[model samples]
Target chain A: MKKTINIPLGSQHIALLEPVRFSFTCENETIVGVEADVGYVHRGVELACTTTFKFKQVGYVVARVCGLCAIIHSTCYTLAAEELMGQEVPRRASYLRLIANELDRIHSHMLCLAHTAENAGFEALFMRTMKDRELVMEAQEAMTGNRVQFDYVSIGGVNRDITTDIEALIRQRLGLLKEKVGEIKELFENNWSLSLKYKGVGIITAENAYRNSALGPLARASGIDFDVRNESAYLPYGELGFASVTMSEGDIHARNMVRLLEVFESIRLIESALDGLPEGEIAAKVRGTPEGESYMRVEAPRGECFYYLKASKGQYLDRVRIKTPTFGSVPAMIEALKGANYADAPAIIASFDPCLSCTAR
Target chain B: MFKALLNALKNLFSAPATLNYPFVSSPKHQGARGLILFDEPKCVWCLKCEEVCPPGAIRFTQDRESYAYTYHYNPYLCIYCAECVRACPDKAQALSQCSELSRPTSDPFMNDAWFALEKEAEDSKEAVKELKKAKKTEETPQP
Candidate 1:
């Protein structure tokens, strides 16, 4: 009766949004081991960054790395490029960047929550969450002129500025979204079936989280207090009173709770940034090319997104390395998947919200 | 359990959340980037759009005798980031979200419609310039 069987989850599956394969070894119904394959979606973004795109345009090129966190990719690349050129972004542009980044976080978190709900067989909850997510999408489109892949951030500053009309629209939509998120939070917290599927399942302890270098809501759910927004001086997150939300439990429920709580914090940060929006030029004049090598890190929805650029006084970059969060969190995801019930596998995977696009790119 | 029952009751009275596409029309925000638009007259033939396009979606060729340029656009390769739109000095390139999605094709002519567009624009501008020169000659009183 102690026989082991191999089960392959996906390079393609209904439960997965992107192509990532996980082979699980299960003894009866309980998983004993996991092996992940994450190279399905890689389109040679690193090679393209150096060969195809110029320094001025690489900001937008990196935005194509991951659709969900496109703004963050551009922002991080722009920050590094600005650092290389010794460019000082305007205060208003900094505030706008903060606003856009937080909006992206809200939408991405909602998407993860929706996917989790769908994977758990709560089809109604998935639909409800997606409907609410549209509010944030509307705000993003109104601000940056695109729903996803905004290409909002440029090297010196942002490409667009906010007007009173855009501000009012964002405020109104965020207000509506806050209410809907509250309802979703109640469902996640008190719903009996959700609790049964999520509570104490696929747990990662604080030690494992640290050992595996897990990050974003995954690490925070394990009580590890680390967020690039708090630590980095890249944007105006500090002035906006950015606070990283955390929870002690590291279950699927705990991860969902961390995301839900962080949505409120992100809303608060956006409101504060918009309230203190300074009046100035949206972009700065660029006179010189980026020369020196520099590195930048940003907190994407899943975790830390890092960019390393090496330039040598040319229009083309010498080297570009993007180390996305999902790349580092794969080991942790495997560790969590091991010892979990095979039936609970999809739900656990959905909880991590592993973005293979970002991982492979 | 009570909340779930109440939620089910509330859902019974509410309208369906899903959009009836093609019948009700899809939702698009005003600033959403959907289609690439060109103003051939306003284009200065600088080739900045070609230079800055991330996926090489744009192709440009010029005729030396006419001093007119031909531009081609492949929507399939375009990422729709509107980098060319931002880079346009004369604001010749633009994006609109309300456009219909094209069926994907590998046909060569389908991707080169932008060349025909630029050619039409150049011919029209040439005609207008000739007409303006003729009117100037007529007003000069046989000088």
Candidate 2:
């Protein structure tokens, strides 16, 4: 005879950044089943986008969807708007957009890494990752005019242009960050305690990842070669020699390694983008209103962020639909949590790097 | 184990990584978006900032009788996108990277310099009406 008990992990927890509830049914110490509720932070952002904001202002409005990936949100919407209006973005503006997006990815990946280390009870690693992350934040601020929510990408072009002084600053800081990340990467790979806590835990097989439609590093870790940056022309990712990082294990360690390796790729892309920076107008003359429907997708730090816009020849939009990456990954997250030990649950949750704000909004 | 000890020794000799906040501010990269600065004299009361603001952070109002315009900016609601700064034709509003956003007891933004223009326009309308009346009375005597 087996005795099972239900334990609730969160609606509010010390480890979680946003509100999400999880109830795990455990047989002794092993979790037999898991259920998640992800609507705790929903503020009706989709409804507000269509009803309240005009087509021109929706780019900035959608930036409020997620602070970590604000530039991606604005850029995706701007791309759709430009497509509908038949406007052409200059090469220089596209390069600026690419640089901002990659910088955002670097900082976001570092934060997720820090959070995972903190969950594993390694206080020093958490602090060190955060300290090194500041270098990327400094680069972001110098170029975008804001640290987190930059409002860098507008409809026709970007809001701020990068000067030569800012360019030198970015190159210097990224050089320093690359050296520090190498140290952090070595620790994640070789440290005994982290290996014990992270290795072979919360495994998501390639089949499970595909069946549940997992995205981003989650899918990549499971040997799924799907990255929006490779598929979409929303940005000049290919011209900058973008490469997707993939692994086979699909465990917590593999996920961490995938993000770690991608950071290096992101740095390379940023450097190449700067090296080939073009000379042209930063903005184009946009005229008329957007008519008909358009869909846009961009590779956010987490996964694919998709936006759907339906507009007439009016100032306001007819409908605005946003499909955030975390929303699509919830089912996959639940699948990974089952059969894991109760004590390892927080580590598993942090490994997914779920952005509940983005999911709910 | 040796690597752990080596890292510990390195950290012990190096300066602390943490910053002393409020005593010593963290270093900000260039082009940081901070508090907003409003220049009232340059504003023409076009209300473009109010229209373009995503969060409705900036509001412009007019007193119909006096024709005076007043502006209000709620720093709490502002997202610091600087869309308002870009939308203004006169460049009346700008962003300051070093200025901090503080909570005040009362609203700090209110301006009304367009009252004189409104009054002059009203007086000219009245003068035109009086001239038409004088012309009508003279024509009536002739008829």
Candidate 3:
């Protein structure tokens, strides 16, 4: 008889939102060894960026890599390209970029929370969270002019200006969202049944998180106290008074708590960003092609999204290297799954908020 | 569980949250990025929109004999990023974006026709370049 049985969860599974495969070698009911394949959704975006699109157009090309974090990808790429060109972005443009990025974070965190609830077999909570998410979606559409793919970031600055009417819409919607999120946070923190599915399950210790290089909410849950936004000047997060949320338990529940608290922080940041939005032209004139190599990293909803651009003053870039958060979180994911119960697999995976479209691209 | 029961009961009597999709249309907000609109007379034939469009949704085919240009747009191929509108020169103001989204086409050959047009657009540009070179040579004295 075989000592252990291998069970696969993904590449096509009911629990997954994107295509990623995980093979678990289980000893009885516990997963003993784990392997993950995050390349199932690869679309050859890097090759297309270098060979097909011009430097000015590559911002739009990379935005299609991950739908949930589209703005982050474009913002990171635009920042890097601008660095190569020595472009000066207006103060107002950076604030608008920050606002859009935080809105992206808030909605994405809500989505992961909803999925986690659904995975835990709490279907009603999933629906409720999804319902609350629409408020932010409407606000985002009003601000950036699209529901999902916000092509708001451009080479020098942003594409759209913040009118007073749009500002009022965002404030009203975010205000409603803040109230609703408070209720949801209470439910996540106090609901007895939810604690069963999330508490002390699939824990990643602080040292383990450091060793495996887990990032974003995953690492923050493990008390890592590391966030790309606080660590980098890619955006104006520091000036926006950004503060990262963290927890010590390092379990599914802790991750959820971190994400929920981060939502509050993100909403506050957006409100402040709006209030301090300087008066200036939305877009500065883009005059030249990017030359030489430049690197940039931005805090996407998942984690740090890094972009490497090497241009030789040409229309098309020589290379565009993207390193997404899910790719970095894989080792930590495998580490967490080692001793977890097989039944907790889906819930644990959802808590990571893995965006395989980003990783594989 | 009792709290859940009360909430469920109260929610059952409340009006539904979702809109009636078939009867009530959900319109995007004002200035929502959508379809690109082009004006023929206002265009200076600068070909700037064609150059900046990422997905090559906008193309211009030049007449080889008359040196005139015709603008071609495929809404199906467009990503609605509005880069063309921004790229259009300020004086021309020939390009703008409206909030109406692209509708799905019933034509089976829509994509095929677009692909053919893309190839023709490239070939026509090449032909125009060759014609311009010939004209320049005819005017210059032979070495």
Model 1: how far residue A248 lies from native, Å: 0.5
DockQ of 3: 0.74
TM-score: model 3 vs. ground truth:
0.98
Residue-wise C-alpha lDDT for candidate 1, range A1-361, written one tens digit per residue: 5599999999999888889999999998999989999999889988988997888888878888999999999999998988998988888888899899999999999999999999999998998899999999989989987788788888778877788999999999999999999999999999999999999999999999999999999999999999998898788888877888999899999999999999999999999888888998998887688888899999999999999999998999999999999999999999999999998999999999999999899
List ranges where model 1 is wrong by over 4 Å.
B90-108, B111-143
lDDT of 1 by residue, B17-121 (tens): 878887987765556655566767677788888788777677665554564667777777777777777788754543322344433345555535756654655
Clashing pairs in 2: none
Over A107-186, each residue of candidate 3 has an lDDT whose tens digit, in order, gives 99999999999999999889889999999999999998889999899999999898999999999999999999998898
Model 3 off-target regions past 4 Å? B1-3, B104-109
Instruction: Output the better candidate (1/3) by DockQ.
Output: 3
Question: What does the lDDT read for residue B134 in candidate 3?
Answer: 94
Residue A222 alpha-carbon offset, candidate 3, angstroms: 0.4
What TM-score would every model get versus the actual structure? Answer: 0.89, 0.89, 0.98
lDDT of 2 by residue, B1-143 (tens): 46766997898899997788889977765556765567787777777877888877676555544546666666666777788887887444432323343343466433332344334445654666677788789889674
Q: Which DockQ value does candidate 1 get?
A: 0.46
| Native A-B interface contacts kept, per candidate | 0.71, 0.75, 0.79
Ten-residue stretch with the least lDDT total in model 2 chain A = A141-150
